[model samples]
Target chain A: MVVDIAPMIVLGMVILTSLAFDFTNGFHDTANAMATSIATGALKPKAAVSLSAILNLVGAFLSVEVALTVTNSVIKIQDSTGAPNPALTADGGSALLLIVLSGLIGAILWNLLTWLLGLPSSSSHALFGGLIGATIAGLGFSAVKWVGTGAKLDGVVGKVILPALLSPVIASLVAMTGTWLIYRITKTVAEKFRNDGFRWGQIGSASLISLAHGMNDAQKTMGIITLALIASGQWHDLTAVPLWVKGACAMAIAMGTYIGGWRIIRTLGKGLVEIDSPQGLAADSASAATIIVSSHLGFALSTTHVATGSIIGTGLGRKGASVRWGVALRMLVAWLITLPSAALVAALTWGIGHLVGGLAGAFVVFAILLVAAGYMLWHSRKNPVGHHNVTDEWEASPEGLAPELPKEVVR
Target chain B: MSQILLALQAAGQVLLAAVILGAGLPAMFSLGMRALAYGNGGSAEVEVEAQPHVLGKVLAYICFGVVIIAVMLGISWIVGTGMGYKLSFEHFLPVFRKK
Candidate 1:
């Protein structure tokens, strides 16, 4: 049965798909901001998520430069003449929509699968990976604007990877210096006071880290939506992000943050390393610094990676702190695979769009996605993860209960 | 006039449709979850403890802020350089000078 679809209807599908991506993005990356505090008993799981949600909203207003970059720089738009312009027809619009939706599905599925297995993966990588994969599949290799790809890659390597690799080292140095200074200056101060002082410091540091995360991570979706709009020729130039776009993206991400990515939180907060108050403070401080700086400069670095590095560095900084190499290794594997995988999914979806043709094809694809997503949600209800169980303990096991810590670590 | 109106109509249709679907569904879902959580009388208290030292906490906050700003600058510099702009600390800040 063939059904005629309107341009407006197609546009609606794309927007919904984008929001779905945003929603998944929120829960997927929540652990980046709240993991350490949850692990160290600094904040209750629910309270931590609530705080992150509010800060994410506030942070979204701070910048739109990154969104502009995403729309204009990352995705190259072409005109009807097939020249490089940002005017898109109904066909191009639907293709872009399908690619984005497929990318989100791939990312959401990967996140859930990883979370179920108690692995802390990079949500930022997952989203990028999905886009890359879908774009490659739909547009083929040539459809990828090599210049934009190259520029983005350079940023990823120099700004994202280098800083991530260095953050822990830098953090350790700063932390060691800070710790040493505290000891030297306050030798006469009581041990209890020293610990108390640092704890208060951690609270402020942790809040900043959460705020920074919102500033950097949420902009990514804004960029994606803008790219879609520009590619379809809805916008003439890469100018300001519309107020509605900003509000919607911010709201979607904030809501996701409120829901929390419990699975990742479990792995990060408890599985990787035991966090004390001082270590939590140090890690959060480092993460906040890296994320905020990256956001200001408009580098779309993964907050997950920076936060993970900080936590690892903090662990190493503390004497005899056990680092779980096995889990860390697993997370690294996911990071390596995210981009290529999502790109492939997008490409395949694009091919399907070609076969179906125009509005009919778009509807067919959208219906399939809805049915599949609905089925997944139904299946997930058998073992759902919700607010009652959105904590480290609940996420530690598949059964929504905390399992016993390993024998050596329990000591 | 007809052609221009047609183009504007197309753009408006697309934009309006996306807002309803993309932003609307998630907002509704989130609101639903929040209502459920509140109905259950969930505690609003954050469980995390504050670090005790005012000075240490202040320093950490300052350091954290500096790092975020630096990273943002670094990203912009890298992207800008790739796009053929000269790399400098000034480029990292908002005060960009015309060449």
Candidate 2:
């Protein structure tokens, strides 16, 4: 009997790539929960990220949901029971492994590129787009779940596209109402009292978002890692993720949060709007409420869209405040293309991996992902936006999304 | 069309709940701060003539209490959902049932 090691090698690559994706996901989304708080000075930049990181760790562990079928929304790789198709399991599961590997590479590369550009694109959308693209390349276009049977919300149109369009609008309305009411009710209160009180409120609401984010985002990575495990025949239980996988995923996300994606955070906190403590409190509350409510209703939406919408809503609600339409327009463009852009990259990656074939193909894709990520990291260093300058005042320049260099640095 | 309709339905529910909790909680908190200001009187409000009132302080705490309870319920809901349970308002009070 001859034993093949190709699937095992590909499986290892998938796990590593999935964790890398999770890490990017953590830092990429820290802005969604903490940007307003940081902007309002409700929490110092370091303290805000630390608190968010800790809460995310706690949140990751709290999730006990069987999310193994997470990919069902966008692709048909797995059945409702979360098991990989038997057809794809032949030859040590290399077929399924290649697809998963290429998909993860697509997600990670897109995430890094967006982070470099300081765009708050949806991490979930990128992940789904990558998977969709890779599946199309490997299993034909029919493998993608563009729409469901209409019994309930499932598939790309129902789960991803529709929610992307609707969530922001819903979040905006809720936040606008909240912001207007908050300002109205506290009109006569002393400036000192009002600022102090709303700052506390911002902290509380932002904490809720971070906790919820941990439970939501980490589970996606956990599901992917488990799927890879099952594909390689290393794990049998479809309903429960291995304990080590959970622990590793939780740590990856928490560490990523602690590192903080200062570039994207700066965009959300400073570029989009001029946020005060009251607006911050309102925006965070709206985001938290919309996310929790929608998820409970089984209508999954990206936290990025909801947070961005809430921020814009706060601007609209305030009498003198106005949104920077240029910044807003840029974000809209990013959101519109996130799916297709990630999909294109993933499809291309799948092509390259398929051409090379077997374990060597997986290594080639992984190497490309690393090189792309490194280039983005290097480029980001040119205009480093760390905790030190994350809350710097916003100034529009010819270089869009680039913050004005700190006064001390310029001097 | 059905997908759109179903999404609209879900969005409607989310919007309604978001308004009630999202806007409502912050409003309540603002009201509490206002009440606290009224209670503290001097330097707590822009009006110099305002006087401290015991009743205002009590009212402020009550508002804060309600806001805190709502947040607690939100947290509980997240935890409940994770544990394969659903938090439902059966008789105007939340109860957890198997999902």
Candidate 3:
């Protein structure tokens, strides 16, 4: 029996697309860990992302619960009716590959789009929505378990939807309490001393967040890639992810984080609220707590949501601090749209893959993905936001993001 | 559904830990700064970097020591679990185990 090259080609495509999504995930969510630190001068912007990158790499080694949740939770790759006969196995495997590839494409594209818009949306949601959409397209709606029974949460509602709805609220409340307390307890402290002291505190809190982000986000890509491997019959009966997969996912995410997403960092650090050193320490500490606990429990809470909520909470908690409610509302709308928009992208991608036929179809979809990504990269050059301008004051719709420029330049 | 309640309870646990550990650390740091003020640097106005008073300095160290312990516990919980060891806070000392 000659080995089929088509499946191999499909698997290679799956790995590549998955890594691309992981890379986007790295940069897109870097702000969640490092933004406040950068904005508050806890660390320099380049230094912040670099430190976050290193911690994330270290964090990636610390947890696999989220990865397990992602891999086994979403799609049913096998024929449950009976043991896999050759034809049935082939059909199921190929269809699963198509689903994963389209899902990754949808996720990566959505990540880049949101990055371009300076929206710190959830990369995890984009990933979930894409996979669910692809599964619906390929194996019909039955492939997705909307809700799972018992304490084991392996369904969309249990693992994905509920957390999305609740995490921001919980995160905000925790941050608000923390922020309010930090100021209350230190009410008599000198302004300069408070600022200087909290800036030092931020280093510890911010490092925890980076480690937690790595602990949480890297495993998500690991889970999806491992799922693809299992569907392709490479693992046979292997339940655990291989060491190489872990290393690759860690590297992909770390490299992406090191590159950074400056626009999102700008928006998160300076856009939502005028962050000060005290608020920065409070927000980062709250985010770290929420993320670590949730990751421990295997609830894949979005670090983006938590960070954004924590920033806004600091505004609510601190006296005389102004929260940009308009920006907050805009972010809420983006959060709501994340699921449906990513689903639409995944569905369209799956449709394209279906229309093209076999390996050629996969290749065509990959080519389109590359071109779209290239366009986004080219488009971002217009008003390139990087480490230099990342801490600029927040200007809402002014010439050249004037408000977001640092006070010295804005003056 | 029960899922909502369970999720709520889980959220509550995180919130509690967040208040005690996350928010607590920064506040403790602030207290450390305040204690340093109480020491040789009596005034908050000038910004006391040296913190020369022995008692204020010692109190500041205690406050920071508590925060550092909390941080070490947090990291151990994360990194420990990765190596198949579960670290849970119990009475007095922590319980660490291989799962």
Write down the C-alpha DockQ for each prediction: 0.02, 0.87, 0.55
Query: What docking class should model 2 receive?
Result: high
**lDDT (10s digit) by residue, model 3, range A179-210:** 88888877767777778878878988999998
Residue A219, candidate 2: how far off, in angstroms?
0.8
Ranking by lDDT: 2, 3, 1
- TM, every model: 0.69, 0.96, 0.92
Whole-model lDDT per candidate: 0.57, 0.91, 0.80
Residue A222 in candidate 3 has what lDDT?
82
- On DockQ, the candidate that comes out on top is 2
Per-residue CA lDDT of candidate 2, range A206-299, in tens?
9999999999999999999998899878999987999999999999999999999998999999998999899999999999999988877889
Which candidate ranks first by TM-score, i.e. highest? 2
lDDT of 2 by residue, B1-99 (tens): 899999999999999999999999999999999999999998999997899999999999999999999999889989988888988998889999998
Order the candidates by DockQ, highest first. 2, 3, 1
**Winner of 1 and 3 under lDDT:** 3
Model 2, backbone clash pairs (residues 3+ apart or across chains), number? 0
* Model 1 spans > 4 angstroms off: A1-5, A71-75, A78-92, A145-195, A231-237, A297-299, A371-411, B1-99
